[model samples]
Target: MISTRLQDAINEQINKEFFSAYLYLSMGQYFESKFLRGIAHWFYVQYKEELKHAEKFISFLNEKGGRVILNGIPAPKVEWNGALDAFNEAYNHEKFITSSIEDIMKIAVEENDFSTQNLLNWFLDEQVEEEAQTLEIVKKLELVGEHGQALYMLDRELAQRQG
Candidate 1:
């Protein structure tokens, strides 16, 4: 059985994942309002993917016979300064998530929960990709530096992203 502390943390992580989805969807709406359809579409896809991640954690908990006590998600920021700002926020959030995953791994180590640790291995690898993606976008945005046409082009490129 998973420790209550560990289960609670994991449950909280699940909520955060859902919150991420909500946040991205909100960003998508904002982008659409700005008439940046490509960016909006990219965020919409990202939102769906984040929801999938939340569900994955939920299912993993269920498979482990742990109760998923969902908690409330905090409100996400509504206003972004611009496309670059929004993506920078996303990149920062991804970093936070990466650290959280690392902390969970530390807890697993302390508990000697080999099974839990093994399961988290997948997340560790996934986090690498997550960080890479967000960082890439941030770098590209930085390079473009307030260039609308370039931003639009990047959006077009991102819109091609598929699961």
Candidate 2:
């Protein structure tokens, strides 16, 4: 059985995961509006992955006999100065997520909940990869510096993302 404090924290994280999905979806739409199809596709893939992450938490909660309570997802910002601006936001968002996972891990450790700690460990590792990928894109965008051809090339590269 899950402790009340842990259960509440997990439920909150579930809501956060859903909000992350929504944010990525909004970024996808923004890219589409700018006619950056490949970038849009990349954000769409991220959106789906976020949904899967939320489902993982939901399933874990159920398995632990905890209540699943979802909250409303606030609207995400739909505009950016350009591709660099958007990818920078993405990178920042990943950092925020990493911090959130760390907070949860702290809670699990304090409560001596090894099961929850094990589950969060996966997310902690994932957050590292997530931040790295987004930051790489951000760095490339910075180097390209508003160059139309370079941006197009980057878009094509991002299009290769699968699942």
Candidate 3:
């Protein structure tokens, strides 16, 4: 059985994951509005991935016999200055999520919750990939700054991303 504190933390993380999905979806819409279809598709994929992350947490919590009480997700920012801005925001959010997972890992350690700690390790590794990918995109966008052809090529490359 999960401790009450750990359970509450897991519930909070689940809600955050949902919010991440919402934020990515909103960004996807923003890209669509800009007519960057490939970028939009990428964000759509990210949005779906975030939902899967939430479901994974939910399943873990259920397996631990913990009650999950979902909280409301706040509105995500829909307007970005450009692709660079969107990717920067995403990279920042990934950093925030990494910190959150670390906080939960600390709690799990404190509570001697080995199972929860094990599960969080997966998230920790995921965040590393998440942050790396976003940052890499940010760098590429930076290089393509104010270059229309380059941006177009990058968009085409991004569109080829599968899953």
Candidate 4:
């Protein structure tokens, strides 16, 4: 069985993951409004991935004999200065998520909860990929600044992303 502290932490993470999904979906809508279909598609995929992450946490908590308690998700920002600004926010959000996962891992270690530690190990690796992917987009957007053609090309490349 999971400890109350760990259960609470996982529940909080599930909410954050859901918020991440909402944020990405909002970003996708922003891109769609800007007529950047490819970029919007990319954010759509991110939204799906975040939803899956939340589900994964829910399943894990259930498997550990813990109750799942969901909370309300706050509204995400609906506007950005540009693609670069949006991607920068995404990168920063990923960093924040990475830190959150690390905090859970630390708790698991302190409590000698091997199962939770093992689960968090996967999240730690996933967070690395998440941060790296967003940071790469931020860098690419930086390079394409004020270059409509370059931004369009990058959008095309990003649209090719699957799942």
lDDT of 1 by residue, 1-163 (tens): 8887778888988988899999999999999998888888888988998898889888888888899998888888889999889999988888888788778888889999888798788888887887798888889888887576897798788878776
What candidate 3 gets wrong by more than 4 Å, as runs, is none
Give me the runs in candidate 1 sitting further than 4 Å from their true place.
none
| Model 3, span 3-62: residue lDDT tens | 999999899999999999999999999989988999999899999999999999999999
Better of 1 and 2 by TM-score: 2
Over the stretch 82-145, how does candidate 2's per-residue lDDT look in tens digits?
8889899999998988888899889899999999999999999999999999999999888887
Q: What is the C-alpha RMSD of each candidate to the true structure, in Å?
A: 1.2, 0.7, 0.8, 0.8
Please report the TM-score between candidate 4 and the true structure.
0.98
TM-score: model 3 vs. ground truth: 0.97
Q: How badly does each model clash, as a count of residue pairs?
A: 0, 0, 0, 0
